[model samples]
Target chain A: MTEPSAKRGIAVEQAVVYGLLTALGLFAFVVALGYGLFLDEFRVGPGLVPAVVGGLITLIAGWELVATLRGQRTPHDKGLAEIVAAAAEAPPGGVSSDDDLPGGTLPSGEQAGEGTSDGVDIFGRTAAMRGRQLVIVFVALTVSVLLVPLLGFLGSFFLLSLFISAAVERRSWISATIVSFAAVAVIYLVFVVFLRVPLPAGLIGIGG
Target chain B: MLDNLVLGFSTALTPENLLWCFVGVLIGTVVGVLPGLGSTTGVAVLLPLTLSLEPVTGLIMLAGIYYGSQYGGTITSVLISTPGEASSVVTTLDGYQMARQGRAGAALAISAIGSFVAAIISLGLLVALAPPFARFALDFGPPEMLAVMILGLATIVSFAGDNRALGLLMALTGLLISTVGVEPGSGTSRFTFHSIYLLGGVPFVEVMIGLFAVGEVLYQIREGAAAPIRAGFRELLISKADLKRSAAPILRGSFLGFLFGILPGAGSTLASFMAYGIEKRVSKRGHEFGTGAIEGVAAPESANNAAANANFVPTLTLGIPGGATTAVLLGAFMINGIQPGPLLFDEQPALVWGLLASFFIGNVILLVLNLPLAPVFAQILRVPYGYMYPMILLTSLVGAYSISNSMYSVWVVLIFGIIGYFMKRLDLPMAPLVLGLVLGPLFEKALVQTSAIGDGNIGIVFTRPLALAVMALAIIQIVAPSLMARLLRRRNSSRARKADQAAEDKTEEHSHG
Candidate 1:
């Protein structure tokens, strides 16, 4: 009836989430307090504000956890079901409690009014795991960012473009080459040469 | 007055702005074709590329993206039932159905035509009426401004997912987040924590990229990918009848969009939502709304585009931003030593008029491009999940990094991406969260400034007639929908029970016979 591949829904899970937030808040408060210390002699220093913010975020996260554990449901949802519903967050249709269902989650490929006994897939632990696929793409992007200054905009753009088409878009080498080249040439011609917005070039950069 | 705007035809007609506008629309169209991405993010990502350009050209490009994306959003909504933004959520009802019924082509054509028609009408309205409207809005004091902000509050209930408080909580979080670096009024470092990066408050673009783009990527990765779809080109056009039926909805939505566009802070999403709601109430067969009505797509698509251009009024004339895109545009204006205000019309007549003129030109061009290229764009709907998942993640991070060039921003992008992922899983409305975060500072700025003027009088929200009226309206906007839904559910429930009983009797009679 509910999502808990690891375990059933429990207050401890909610408490743990909240407690971590509170700990974070406390850490922030300590950081802020440290900022007030001037060479070991404490006076009002710069950390006062950050301390407060971190403290607040922590507190809010904590309070939310506490509320969840107590079964005092929030105006927002936090459970696995809530996450799944929120993913696609569609309006309910044909279901008995469609209107009241907190519906935001990763859109499971369920057509409206279609659900299977296997499990409601709008969200599940599987979606959370699949999130790692995002990391590979980001890593490729970071490398591209560093390369832009090193190899020059056109050069870096070419390499990055190819990498992305192949790595991300999953195109064939020949296709990635054709598309990347075309895309870069267009960007270079329009943005760099035509429009005259200075793009990064390794040691030969302009646009100050 | 029309002539003055037409005077801008010379500057806008320059081959340069026209070309960029085309580019902008193309990029926007591409972005919109992708599911889980929308206009605001498109504008935000593109803004940096335009910083070095003349303000007007950059703004024209941004405007193109704004409306162009709405046109593109419909293509996906109809074909795949995915709404990249909340404004098009209603479109999925009829759009996907039409696709299923093999009328995908019709849905695409009608939505595009409807959007173009509405956009042109709105552009005409904007050119003819915006300046005078601005002059009137210039007179809005703190109370009146408060009223406008309060009116924005009304969106919370409609947007507030299952629990209104959650929306408020998110809004409060946004408010706090906005107040991160320096307390503008007090000049106190309220939350920076002595970090040099914190000296400047969180950048709106960075936050938007994190919340919308990155967050969406995380969610997409988790859900996995849709099965491969191979739609042939022949499957994408509408019959003449579809166009005829959608025409009235397009007109109604356009008018609604224009009116909403005229209002400060009431952005495209609200305009579309309202248009859809009205279409539902007035439809001869309102009961068919969810099951699949072309009216769903027609109404919202028209309204979003109409509201999109209309939103430019506050951004340009009053030096006030009505929504996220406008706020970014305001940044562009400030960067170029041009303050967008009443004086702007007098000082930079060419810039203003040219921008207005380009809107018309852009809409026409976009229509031409979309009508012919609908099938090509629809092909984007078929890209496999394995390819799409990794690509979405890549673009999101790169976009985030480009916004701020900082690891912390990247971290925030990841964090929010995760939050978005989890939020999607739980069924919490991300629209309200994004809206709140984007508008929170504006709301707070207005509230604080208004109260400051009232000199600690809490009743000023109601005591001031303008503020009072708007406040009351806001309250109703929030409370009314939920109440109506409750009443509707009751009616639906009772009706269903009665129908079931009648069916039971008929079954009994048939058996007896």
Candidate 2:
């Protein structure tokens, strides 16, 4: 009974994706057209390939959008039946759950539906947890990058690894600290000492 | 040839080269066993480190990593039902089932042994054929090169996944992305948007790290925890009957995989799939394919390894990469100012021969490393995601930063990581995209060169017999997959309709009775 709605949802999602891709293609096409098709002496200009590629992309994306609107399933949707069949044949207790299955959930977690604060549902909990972890990790990486100029490579790396492990992943602080330090030290030695990479050194600067 | 081989052995047998080979394979094995990271990511992440080393030694190490990961990929597939590499996807069908039935050791052992045997066979073929192939390719002009590139792209697009259009789209997108910097011939600014960083172009290695490593880490984290399987040392041994049963499949898979691998863009993943499919059709116990069939495990494992070695053929001889890992290796070659082509053998015999000889040594190292450590490697599954994912993120970030020592590259990694995540969600194949990005500049150059050579005549491509033949092949490749799929679907539907009609007739008879 819910199959139709699921199909519609996927179609809508695909349409949106294709629409965005078409827009990107159109933008690139316009920009590339401005760059001109030929330079001096009949030589092909920089814009030629990009323009053609952009045009192709626009055409393909438009076709995809129309297909989606016409209720055609994306290639991924067609593969789901195979996946389901394979999952069914999987050994007893081989899979932890359907949620853990590869390609099971949408990246946005929209397919899993909404999550409650209590987190009773396994799928909801997993989606919510994953979303939180992804954000945390992303932020951690961004902060680490920002910190590299101020704190130097080793200092920033140590802090980044520690924060991600201890705070984000929720590992024990002691172990995180140990692992972070060890990892940073090894990287420092390898890049700076042995390979002679001349990594950036900021406030606590020791010139390579 | 023999003298060159002796020289190769002399260079490869050096302590420095041997050590690097071991390190490369070791790192490859670890990354390969990890669920998210594959040989592509492994080679990309480690590439910057190799930049400081001698070109020959670095390449030998990189080559080791390339094939070593094939052996490592089997470990996860056999033990966990998770394929560590895309090529290992088929291995999970019967391998995980065998693991569930308490034969994890046997599965792991057979996979390692099969991979080793296939590696040896493929390596021998590579040595025998690569020089002649390169010599033949030396005759190829711009039109022929373009045709070959087109063929490669077509094969990848056709075989990428269920969606041919999506694959083509991704490949086109990659080509578009590659056009972001300065134009090669005209010295004109491209889609740089006036930024200095953009002027230099997007760093390929950073993009690779972001897409494969960071994107993969995010996916794994989202997957949460999976149930871990434990395999003891006792389970590592395969029975003599098991070996006898696997022997034919291994040999068949090796040859099939090698053939597929030598073709441009049809990589180890396709080779493994084809091997599994062929094995199912040919084996006596074919009906029991997805249910703990030893041949199922042996075929794909052996095939992937063979394909991994065979990939070097095109990469070295034609300067064309068969897959993503080889694309990175191609980048590595360029980074070292060593252009890989027909001229490479003549220009740098030591580097070429030494790298080949190292493959022989590296395969031996991998066989030794994988067999005894299969059970030990399985224990890596016991490591909590919490500990592992954070370290992966750290490595990715550091790897990205270290590449150019620029914060911009780090940002590139982060951005591409997100893009990769979304691409995965949308079920876009990443390989075609990477291939396009890597091959885009070369494709463009070939196109321009062909145009100039032909005096702007579009029909000149048809004039060259070799180019015409390749184009014909490309067209067939593009048409064949869909044609086969349609036929298969029609056959299945007709059979189902017949079954339904028979059931209805039976019901009518019962009602009359």
Candidate 3:
């Protein structure tokens, strides 16, 4: 593994990402091969598509990993940087656009250096801050999902919303509580009252 | 066609459908204005709510969001230099300049009008062509279908991002994910891993919500908040000269966008960019393009809306999605127990035509709403990300739970949300992966059928001329870009050499004199 530095961190990250994908692809291929015969009754069997897809993944991911190790930049690097820089410098008026376009991402290798730790991401958040925020949100989400079965959907999401607003977003506790309750109320109205969805009751039994 | 129109109107004009259509577009506009929440996320998060409605009504609303967001995306581009949708990115080049010059309202007005005109034009073409296209596709056998699927996958993978290999890898990964459930035809579970939840496979709708909605929310949170701009509505008026100047560009963009949109992988974003690029080349005001020319705003806005409408052609006729959002909508179709494709017209005439008809109504509603209210919608940007994102996360997870009334679906959303975030962080192209997930079972089914039809010889695909033609098209898709790049490089270098020689000749002449 390469040491983490501003200059080499992103490249190392890219390598790790592709390396993991390559490993996952191999695992899928091997597991798929273990799924039994590729053909049954002289017809296409269950493992056939999986085996093909898995093999393709391994080959492609391996190729990408090698290319990354060779310090080859993707063709999109220039386009993505220009676009992301444009998007970052401008005061963005909206949140997320659909990821269906060419300029949706930063380039993989060289461009990540430009959007490094001290740099701001496209939405203007510092890269370091983004990492922290992502971890907090992800942890909160995992906790919320686990709590859903215990605390029920409404109660757990109320706590989840509170955490996000107060902890992750750093709002006052009172504001966070209000936002959380309001959000949960809206959820209750839309899902439970209007749509008649059977949200879990758990111990709270609010929507049950 | 007239009978179909009548039936469509009868279905779409129902008060219930009209109301929901309005609601859908309204929400779509807000979604587009909000950033981070595009039509795909909007549709996926709200899809579970539509489960209780009649399929036609639900589909009408979903389709409305798909197109309505095209109209909504331009508001931010014109006012703030931030496009709410990727399709509107080109508009910002000139649109924000227009805003700086206090012509923001005029830009918004023309964009609204141009989008309306383009929508009508494209919808008319859709009504005339889709049925026949479906009829043509009806002749396709399993081999031809297989070829078409391959073409779709290849086209998307090749054009999706800078790295074709990465795009293809993501797609293959999607297909691998799709293989987790029961095997089609064999009735044997392949990767259930002894979990009851795995038996039905990774749930499609849940994954969509996770990827598009929750994942997007998380990604946006990390990006820091956008500073909202104040847009005044006092000048929300388009001059007659402005209309006249924009008319030709609007028409050109509509047709051009429709052509791009009809292709499986070429989505509205590219269409909008191409429209803007060509307009800059061909318009009389071409040089004034980035200086906030009215034609600049009109062309890309019209093109995006036109392409958004035209996307339905392939979706309805071939059951192939035109982009990621349409792919999600296609999943919505399956969720409602309706399979989309050629036979859709024959089997569900009312639903198909009614949905098409609603596009007209939705466009009309959008125009009316946007012309007077774009600035008002722009105000939505003021809502702090603090409040906005938490609500999005809650809705996404709750929506996931409502899908199956189980924690399993919620867990899937969480897992995929993380994957989606990482994929975004790594700059992976998501649409191909999404399209692959949507098309995987269909692709495999076609392959199996083709093999069976050919007595276990998949080579039968080559025997069929139509299938071979489709395969050739797929190969061309993969090969053409690199070939074109090489040609471009050679041409540029030769031109540079010629210029250098001319300069040298001039220097020698001057010295001799």
Candidate 4:
């Protein structure tokens, strides 16, 4: 009932996971070896637990590798398959430009599952936009963090929120701008004014 | 006991404590109603704010959040079929069906009432048992403590998921990471790699936020949004008949949950699942379980709440956290310079009694708040995921940064968030990892102390009768689940073979005729 290629693919993925785990275990073991297992006073030293833990990791990871090589399936393998399948079924190129248009009707929270019927190609879209979106979001957050020393907490947070709304959620320019500033104001009022946290003040340093 | 209760009530009744309790429950409910945000995340994110308050007040607020979130998770399960917490997953099997059948009101009301009843029952048990349990734990020395911790670890690893090996590996990884800081005994850093920031160790709170909150947001984004069902205020009330029908299951679930909750690593999620399974087997209307039976909604909801309350027994007595949220609470205890163990009951009787009294008050507040607000909270599901996720991200980032006011902590959160996403995709359990991280220092200290006490003898644990017994139990705990699974598999295979043989024989007879 199952294709050989699919089975081979799963085997390959399992091997990769096991191999990575084994590498991590070995690395931890090597690092732990730098410390003494037991001191001269016969008391357990800094590395005792780490050594034991690292050894156990290596043992378990090796077992997992052997099991996978023997054509056995693991829960990790099954979970990975599900993730891959879901990603393959998602809409291509993320949400389209038309959906991002100012007057476009946003789907209700209930219609979230009826994504396929919203007119997207099924094949060649298996590569999910999720990876791209995550990278984008991560980059935005990193930039915001870097900007905090220059722009201050309020300014950095505002810019971050605006980017998320406009670039990620693809909201209209006016709504994104309004929501971003409002959200920043609320955050500043609660975290700085009320909680009295000393948020960083950069160029537009208003509150400390 | 009477005097303790008086002291507890007087303390819990204060205006400041009461206000904080109310705030905690309110926030707990909101976060719990939002899918992908569980009590573990809620407690971790808010823990920093509590650092500024008195220890007793902070603890009361945390406890309120713990139980209130259980009640909140039921709302989403019944209304939208989306379980806001892992413990609520079983509730959705029937709760969502009830929503589809227009009995959403009855389901929601029963869940709330059941949760309230369970909380009171479990709180009674906690008060009655915790003191005695703490007294008993007073006899535990280094070796005994080590045995107990091993038993706890074994229980968690066995029950973590279908693959025991993966769970154990994750827990070991957590322990390894925990060893990165300066060793207390030797004063030498184990795996800091010469970094100054690493001397203080990996921040557990930041890891919790990253793993639970940020990781969940990423997973949700990938899954895409689903439409949540709408409910009106009229549908929030239940008939008397519904209450009558649910009473027995509620009581049964409470007892079962309390029993499970006392066990190390047997958390609310497991308790709820077990309660649902037992209800399906024992209830008169069991056959209709998955099709929106009121008893189904009542049982797991009650069980989870009871389990949440009962988790405090081990946490406050033996200093062993029952699950992830309790682990965070243990960290809170340490942050406030309060060590939770046998000594705690004697050292801080007022604090202990006050916390016990606040549980009752908090449950009452939750009942009054939830009964009228279930519909209101359900309306939160209608909020677009697009708007919600960015806020969640911001909260996680800020929560991590606020802990130590260090950008390094924020970076730790981001790194762990990616790791958590991969772990989820890989089907590795997170709770056991958290348990391992929290317990690592204690476990190592116990191990070292026991060795010194026994003059470096490795068999010191076997010399003590109680420690030996606990070690034996730990071994049994590790072996039992897998053994049972194998036995069940064999029986199922035999049954399948017999059925196939019978069908083959019937076909041959028909052909011959």
Query: What lDDT score belongs to each candidate, Candidate 1 first?
Result: 0.63, 0.78, 0.81, 0.77
Q: Candidate 4 regions off by >4 Å? A: A1-18, A65-72, A75-127, A202-208, B232-237, B487-513
The fnat of each candidate, in order, is 0.08, 0.29, 0.37, 0.22
TM-score of chain B of 4: 0.93
- Could you give candidate 3's per-residue lDDT for residues B314-419 as a string of tens digits? 8999999988889999988999999889999999999999999999999999989998888889999888777888888888888888877888888899989988
**lDDT tens per residue, model 4, B62-148:** 878888899898888777666777678778767877887788888888998999999999999999999988989999999999998
Error of 3 at B332 (Å): 0.9
DockQ for all models, in order? 0.14, 0.28, 0.29, 0.17
- Which scores higher on TM-score, 3 or 4? 3
Model 4 / residue B38 / CA error / Å: 1.1
Winner on lDDT between 1 and 4 is 4
Question: For residues B1-513, what per-residue lDDT tens digits would candidate 1 score against the true structure?
Answer: 867766788888888898888888887787777764567667765665675567788878887887788888777777766665556666776677767767777777778888999988888888877778767766777677667655654454344355554445454455455656764554556567788887787765566666556666555554555544466545556667767778888999999988876655556766776787677667664545555567767887899899888888766776656555565566557546787766788788888998888888888888888887877887876665444443444445444544444556655665666566555545445545554554555554565566566564545667777668877777776676556665555765676677678768888999999
Residue A110 of model 3 has an lDDT of: 16
Q: If you assessed candidate 2 against the hidden native complex, which CAPRI class would it receive?
A: acceptable
Q: Which candidate number maximizes TM-score?
A: 3
Residue-level lDDT tens digits of model 1 in A137-196:
556555765666567655665676688678655679998888777766766665656656
Q: Rank the candidates by DockQ, best first.
A: 3, 2, 4, 1
Provide the global lDDT of candidate 1 against the true structure.
0.63
